[model samples]
Target: MNGLLKKQFGLVLMLMLLAMLMYACAPDEAPVDEGGSSDEEESSSDEGSSEDSSNEGSSDGEISGELEIQYFVGGYGDSWWKEVISDFEEEYPDVSVTEHAGPNINEEMRSRWVSGDPPDVVYIDGAGSSETQMVEDDQLMNLTEWAEGIELEDGSSLVDSFIAEPSTYDGELYSLPLVFDAWGTWYDMNRFEENGYEVPKGFESFMSTMGEIQENEDIEPFVTTGQHPYYFSRGMLYPAFAAHGGNELLADIVQGAEGAWETEEAEEIMSNVEEMVDAGYVDSGLGALNHTQSQMNFLLGDNAFIPVGFWLPNEMEGDKPEDLQYGFIPSPMNPEDEPMAIVPDLRPLAIAEEAENPEAAKAFVEFVFTREYAELFSEHTGAIMNLEGVDLANNENVPEYLIQANEMINDPEQVEIFYKPHPMSADLETPISDSLVSLLLGNITAEEFIQEAEEAAAEYREGQE
Candidate 1:
């Protein structure tokens, strides 16, 4: 009886051991919920759902919305915009981007702006887009607080990375300058080399070099668009003003101060221009040509030099001769001992005051200002971004001239940068552009130019009142 009882106990122990082994090897069942479904069953159902998985990896795991972006497609084109937007969408997978972009996008979107339903982000450039006007209309959000502390991908402060600060009104930032453009003189290095012409550094050398070009080459010495006289007024005249009397004179002139246009510095610069016209250095037929025509003429070697922006090469890219090596120099209006002055034409990026997707808009703004994007910008547009520390020299795609120009622009010893406190009003710029045309054509003397400008400025101020 004792042997039989021992055998029973052994059998019971073996059965219990087998049961535990089977339980450990088998998959555990999830606890049932009140809805008659287990957690694992619900997870399996959701695994096949495309909608539920779409928000994965979104910004903060929550930034899902439609982001509307407006950009001007000019010399820079829309390639950069398209690529950046694609990259942005990938980073924020749940966000859908709608682009309002084209050469005439600014005008096409004007009604929306007027209706107070502007795009979340706007690239303030091309025709019909003015940063100052937008700010005056209270259309842009104040980016001061957010921009001040925002960190870039490399951990640098966003504001600190800008080559130039965002324009501020009463210490409040509204727009961020995205494109860093400066008006300067452009030439063909290959032509210069073939002709043995030295690049001018100052006023005296400029005259001498132009004289050589006129006497030797079949081309005119210099050419600018008389139809768009601001090419001369802003490119040459503004830089000359800054070089002559520093940024103070430029500020005064831009502000339309009473005698700003009538200053000795202004008179001297205008006289120098008049001298160039009198010497036959300027193209007499320029008045008949628009901006592109004038630029094309320069490319055809009809002129040795032209006053324009860095956008020149890109604007005329398709028409450029394969051998046309680009060369750039600041206006060279300064004295030999003085550094060349740069009057930057900054194109800003802003968020609308009523942006429905402010978070996404802010994220887009921050994404664009990185060093990586700056390099990409140079590659796509052959132009510089406003972001600092971009190494374009090592970029094989960028033209040699642009690389050299960037070096000169960033070197304090080589250039002195300045800007108008604000963009000149159309009322003021129109008269100035018109007078500049007259002055360059030798139809008006420097004195008359100053007097007319002062009168027009006074009239504008009175009208403003």
Candidate 2:
């Protein structure tokens, strides 16, 4: 895989780690903290202008300036960003958007942020750049006032339209999550229909389906990016943990709570995957395949399932099998459990606090978060925007899989978690990944995998102290 099509295994790894950690400890229901805002006040669509930042320019609402923007250009391509920019600039004809985007954007923007020459706004989603670090260093502007004070075209407060809490410091939003997706398993819907196979609704049925596929046909039932097992963490292994203990057990282990990692739960979790492998459901050749290869294997009808994110269709746009009806279902880690979606805290676009053009940066934020742009984002990328009222069902161009995911995520009955519980440390990524690899490869049992990860977590926590 190369060019705009190549998969960034590392990005997948980071996101999965987050999926594993963040929500493990998340509250059952995290309402936007009202600090000083009241229920009657919040229920009103129009917020008083008190939150308008003192730094906001007196523009008479005519947004015009040079806005510098950068975004990641990977499988989730930059066409949507460019389209939004064009619309923004057309609306403000006097404005010019300078875009510096690509797969390497995070690295490219590094020196600029260091030299205090970063762009006015950056779409900080992909592999690099840390929104938390940037926030801690005071490099990004706080959107508290504007986000709360400004009314959208619909009269809704800008922040009120999102499912996200205005995760703020001193009522300030350091970053907002604009785009959201969960890693999941996809199958050939047509194949399932033809074979009389029901889409698995729970992990038990999912595993049984895998066994049935192998038992009833020569085709392999499952194939993942064997070279990148973390792909399994989201729709696969994490669901297993969620299955047995719900997020409570997961929270204990991931949050570094006392005596958390040292448990039989780890052993139990590994058994889920082990039983599948023992059932001969996993492809033997999986170890040699990369993400694209394995994905193609499923698309070509050589395999029945591939675990991937919502980006799979776009990434394989050119190579996808003709007339193939792709189908997706969240990993049914536990069949009897209620609906759940693996949401992660990948950061969104934010203005640099040191932005030379603060006004333009704010305008850019406003432009992209609108209903029109959110719809366009979903139509173009097949992923839902985290912003409120941006439903895939509203866009006919959106794929069925995305629409399904959008509905599942927003279903009030379902629980969503912003994943990525990488040990709250700087150095645990590799070692933890190594432990997962060991567990998957059978080089280490589940107990061993948990021990190694716990050891790494211990080292990370100590360093934090």
Candidate 3:
């Protein structure tokens, strides 16, 4: 079997076993008889479900009732959710918490979101559903005032608790960013060092270096997950945004300003991609490879580099190279200056505006930043939380690669920072990804790619009107 299929089959089987195991050892706690009717009892048969454990006390009434929590079960998993919910239950004895999580948790929650019966708290990650779209549609809560003066046990407001405050649009806070996904070009340091390859810093020099390496060694310099070509575009797009014009250009493109995608600055970015394709640096088999196959091929020396996230180590934990020596570099955007690393802020947690239990959702969000919750997050997920001053270096559960990545980005002297996202509408993301993929596969020209994207953006704006 192919690498991706093998891995997927294993995951499916594992999840099946996990379901059976959990069922055998599952706790059957009766619902808390809250005098009134219990919403918790009714939601137990949900698509992704965990029963709200029966709890004592609760007359304090700070924030009571069922907290409908929806979260993505991706690389981070759902263990952290269970840990934090237990903490929330302890803190607010009157409240009942349940877990509703799956790989497609966000997709499953869509009908509820539209019907104004959304979960109190939702993890705003993954594709299809977007926090930005939700904000534009006026379906999200404005957390501005709540953020300014939330009381924490440490006597600091919630605004002061984070390393960086959540992203805002129009001076209104609508979502809270929790998880950090660092994207870049990944390589094997041992192979590079052994082969005496100096990391190239500029786009022109990087292309030259790839040419020289191809001439001298058996190394195939670049490969992208071909079946999912978006993986290649995902990392480089941000640096390209910064190189062309940064936020000013990003705003124009996102707002669907006329001719924004056709500018010379934008062309510079796509042309570089074309140059790579023309030089034959891209893998021929790139069109057939899935993410797992590509990563495995990368490790096996079939290719020298791949575009991936910090979650690489976790994903390939068992299959990683011995003496790993992993290294990362930003996609070179310009010929002269050192390329800026693309560190997009991710908002994984948000409270719905029209939640059945809004106060409880806000309380749950506030409770997430506390020391207990942060440590549990690191311990289970190994993701670098935005909560500052939590030293997780000694935590056994924290992956070593994550610790290295955390230190690399936190030190400002390392490289320039590109702080913006794609800023394109949700509808355009896939089309643009496809366009880039097509360019690499020799099916489309760079100009043709941009034209296709611009056409899609125009359609999106017209529908918005």
RMSD of each: 9.1, 21.4, 18.4
Predicted structure 1, TM vs. truth:
0.84
TM-score of 3: 0.79
lDDT of 3 by residue, 1-465 (tens): 599999999999999999999998989765666575355544532311233322211233346667788887765667778877887899976677866788788778888888887887888765456777787777778888877777556676656776555667777888877875667887788877887887766677778778877877766688888776656655676667665677667666656676878988888888888888888888877888877788888877777778877656666767877976777776666555654555454655777888767777878888886766777777777566767777778877776666776776677665555555333556666666677778988789889998987887787778778
Model 1, 368-423: lDDT tens digits are 88888889988988888998888888889997788999889879898889877766
User: Best lDDT goes to which candidate?
Assistant: 1
User: Each model's number of backbone clashes?
Assistant: 0, 11, 0
| Candidate 3 least-lDDT 10 residues | 47-56
- The C-alpha TM-scores of every prediction are 0.84, 0.76, 0.79
Instruction: Tell me the spans in candidate 2 whose CA falls farther than 4 Å from its real position.
Output: 1-65, 114-116, 129-139, 164-172, 226-229, 240-258, 263-267, 283-289, 335-341, 344-347, 412-426
Candidate ordering by lDDT (highest first): 1, 3, 2
